[model samples]
Target chain A: MHPLAPVTAVGRSTLSMLAAIGRVTIFLGATLTHLVRPPFYPREFLSALLSIGWFSLPVVGLTTLFTGGALALQIYAGGARFNAEAVVPQIVAIGMVRELGPVLTGLMVAGRVAASIAAEVGTMKVTEQIDALVTLSTNPMKYLTVPRVLAATLALPLLAAVGNVIGILGGYLVGTTRLDFNAAVYLTNTVDFLEAADVVSGLVKAAVFGFIVALMGCYHGMNSGRGAQGVGRATTNAVVSSSILILASNYLLTEVFFSA
Target chain B: MIAMQDVHKAFGPKKVLRGVTLDVARGESLVIIGGSGTGKSVTIKCILGLVTPDTGLITLDGQDVRRAERDAFLARFGMLFQGGALFDSLSVWQNVAFRLLRGALKRPRAEAREIAIEKLRRVGLTPDVADLFPAELSGGMQKRVGLARAIAAEPEIIFFDEPTTGLDPIMAGVINDLIREIVVEMGATAITITHDMSSVRAIADKVAMLHDGVIQWTGPVARMDTSGDPFVEQFIHGRAEGPIEAVR
Candidate 1:
C-alpha cells in the first residue's frame, strides 16, 4: 500500500460526494428547464398524473385517517391529566393540517411513487431504452423526468388537501363517538382554529416534498449502475433518499412557517 | 459522412477508448469488430453523442457533432440496440412509429400507424404483430421490430449495435441479410459494432478492427482475411492466443 493511501481515499470519497451533489443539482435544473419547454407530452403527463395522484388517493386517505383518529385518542388521554380533555378537536385539526397530513402523505408517496419511478427508469437504463430515446431524437429528461416531476409537484398538494380533510373527519368521528364531546362543538373547534395560512403551508410543503421525491427517483434511475443489482440499488436509494429529504425539508419548512 | 478524430474516453481510472479515429463515408456500411470490452459500443456511442468523448472531434458532414442542434442532429440517425430496446409499455406499432408520432417528425396518428405497419412488413413481421408488446415477441421477432423501428423514419444514417446478438445462427443470418438489404435500400450511411465474424462478413462493406481502444486495422471486407495484421488475423480466426490476452 502507498504511504498516503488512507488520506487519498478520504479525499477521493469527499470529492465524489460533492460531485454527486453537483450532478443532482444539474439534473434538477435540466428537469425544470424541460418542464416549461414546448414539445410537451400530454399523454405521458396524464399517465403520470393518474399514477402519482389518483392511484395514490386510497393509501393517503387511509393513512391520514388512522393517524388522525389515533392522535385524537392520545391527545384526549394525555389532556385528561390536566383537565384539558376538550382540546382534542383543536389539537387534531392543527396536527393533521399543519404537519402530519403532508408529512405522512409525502412519506407514503416516497415509498410508492419514488420506488416505482426508479425501478422503471433504472430498468430502462440497464436495457438501453434510455439510449434508445436519445437515438430517436427525444430528450430523456423531457420525456421521462419533466412529466413525472410536474405531475408529482401539482398532484401532492391536492393529495395533502384531501388527506387533511379526511384526517379531520377521522378526528371528528373518533372524538364524538369514543369521547363524550358534542359533535357540533368538535366541528366548530376544528373549523374555527384552522387558519388559511396553516393549510397553505402544508400544501406548500407537500409540493416541495413532491419535487424532491420525483427528482431523487429520476436522478437515481437515469444514473443507475449496470445490471439487476444496479437497478435494485437505484430503487432502494431513490426511496431512502427521498424519504430522508422529505423529513429534512419538512423540519426546515416547519421552522420557516411556524417558528416564532 | 461521420468522422471521429483521435477520440479518447476513460471512465475513471479505467480507460475505454484511446485515440480512436475512423470515418464512414456517405452510403457506406462500416462494421467494427473487436473483443468484448474493446470499446466497440463506446465508439459508435461517441459518434451519436450518447457518450461524450474525453477528448476528440466528431463531425457529421464536416460539422462538429457536439455543436449541432440536438434534435435536428439526432433526427438524421436511427439506431438498433443490441437488446432491441423497445419500450415495454408501447405496442409494436407504437414502438416502430415512435419517431413519427412525436417531436419534429410528428405525423397523424393513423398515418404513423400505417407507416409502422409498412416497416414491420418490410422487416418480415406480419401486421398481426402490430398490437403486441415487446415482451410478447421472441428474440428474433424483437430484432425484426427493432430493425423496423430503426428504419421507420427513413433516417439518413443508421447504427446497429450487435444486431445478431442473442439470436440463433439462422436468425442471425436472416437479420444480417435484412440489415444489408435495408442499408442498400435506404442508401444510408451505416455503422455496425459486433464481435461476430459471420455478421461482419454479411454486413460490412469495409471492416475496422478495434483492439485496446484504437483501430488496429481497417480495409475492404475482401482484404480482411489476407490483411496479415496479427490482431485482425487473431480476431477474425477466433484464436485464443497470439497477441490479445483472453483474460483481459
Candidate 2:
C-alpha cells in the first residue's frame, strides 16, 4: 500500500464529518431565522409546549428523584471512611442543584423527546408530508422545527427547576433516614450550601441543552434518508447525537461557570 | 400553465431524469405514466420544486419557476401525496384548512373549518368526517380527504402522486371519477403521476409517457393506445418481455 493511503482515508472521513456538521449548522440557522419571521404558527407552538413540557414531567421527576437518592447514599459511604459523613447533605444538595440534576434530566429527555420527534418527522419525510407542506405554501422549518426548539427551550428550564426541588427532597429523605442525620439540620445545611448562582447555572444549561436536543432531532428528521431503514437510522442518530452533545455541552458550560 | 424545458436530474450513480420537456395548458389534466423508478414521480417533484433539476427551466405562466419567490409561487399550487400525508396530530378539518390558517391566507378558525367541510363535501365526504383524524379513515376515504385538502383553497394548479396506488379496483374507479369531476368543476390545471392505466384513461386530457428521464410520447389520452413508441406500447400492455429489461 502507498504510504499516503491511510492519510488520505483519514482526510476523507474528516471532510465528511465537516460536511455533516456544516449541513446541521445551516439547518439550525434557517430554523432560527424562520422563528423570528412573520407567519409564526402559534397553534403549533402551543401543541409543542404541551408535548415537550407537560407530557415530560413524570419521567423527569422520577429520574431526578432516584439519582438524588443514589448520590446521597454514595457520598455518605465515601465520607464515612474519614468520619466526615456529615458533609453528605451539603454535597448532595450542591451536586443535584449544580450539575447532575440538569444534565441527567437533559439526557433522559433527549432520549425520549428527541427520539420521538425524529421518528415522527422522519417518517413524515419518507412518506412525503414535508413535500406536501411545501406545496401547501407552508415552510416546513417554521411549521416543524421552530415550534419544537422554542418549546424545548422554554420547557426544559422549568423541568430542571422541578427536578432540582424533587432531587433535593430525595437527598433530604435519604440523609435523614439512612444516614441518621437530623432532618432540620440536613435541610439547613442544603439551603446554606446551595447558592442562587448554582441553581441559575443549571437552569441556563437546561435551556441550552434543550435547544441542542430539539435541534438535533429536527435536523436528522428533516434530512432523513428514504425508507424504513433510513428512518430507523435517523431516530437512532438523533438520540445518540443529542445525548452526547448535551453531556459535552454540560461540561463546557460547567467549566465556564465554575472554573477559576 | 406549467412547462419544463430540458430538465435533467441525476442521483449519484443513477440518472433519474434526462432532458425531460413538456407543457401543460390551463384547465388541462395531464397524466404522466411510466414504470416504477422511471422518473415519473421525480418529474412531478421537479415541477413542484421539491427536487430541483440540475439543468433545466421550469416555468409557471411566463415566469421562471426555479427563480420565483418560493412561497408566493407555491401558494398557487396544491398536491396530494401518495400516502395522503395528513398530520397525525391534527383533525381532518385542521389538515384540510392548513394553508388557509397561516401566512397571508390566514382565516378565522371557524371560517377555515367551514371551508374545509365544504371541500370535503365536494369530494363526497360528509361534514362529520372533518372531525376525525386521518388514522380513523379507510384508505379510500383518506384519498378522498387528501383530494378535499388539495382543493380546499381552490388552487390554480394541483399535483396528485399515485392517486390510485393502493386502492381496490372499485375504490380506484371512484377516486378517478372524483378526480376528474373536481378538476373539471374547479377548472384547475392538474398533473397526475401514476402507473394505473385506468387512472390515466379516466383522468387525463393529455397523456405523457416518461421513459429514461425524458417525455417519450405526448398526445391526447385517446391516442395513448395507438402511440407508436415501443416503450409506451410495452408499458401500457404490461408485457413481461419487452425491450425494457427487468433487473433482478
**Candidate topping lDDT:** 1
- In CAPRI terms, where does candidate 2 land? high
Where model 1 places Cα greater than 4 Å from the true spot, the runs are A1-14
Residue B37 in model 2: shift from native, Å? 0.6
Q: List the residue pairs that clash in candidate 1.
A: none
RMSD of each: 1.9, 1.4
Position B75, candidate 2: lDDT: 82
User: For candidate 2, lDDT tens digit of each residue in A1-260?
Assistant: 99999999999999999999999989988988988997788878899899898998999999999888999999999998999899998999889888988898799889989998999899989988888888888888988999999999999999999999999888888888888889999989999888899999999999998998899999999989899999999999999999989989998999999999
Which predicted model would earn the best TM-score? 2
Which consecutive 10 residues in model 2 chain A have the weakest lDDT in total?
A: A35-44
Candidate 2 residues lying further than 4 Å off, grouped into runs, are A1-5
Q: What interface root-mean-square deviation (Å) does model 1 yield? A: 0.6
Name the DockQ score for candidate 2: 0.83
Comparing to the true complex, what docking class would candidate 1 get?
Answer: high
Q: Mind giving the per-residue lDDT tens digits that candidate 1 earns over B111-192?
A: 9999999999999999999999999999999999999999999999999999999999999999999999999999999999
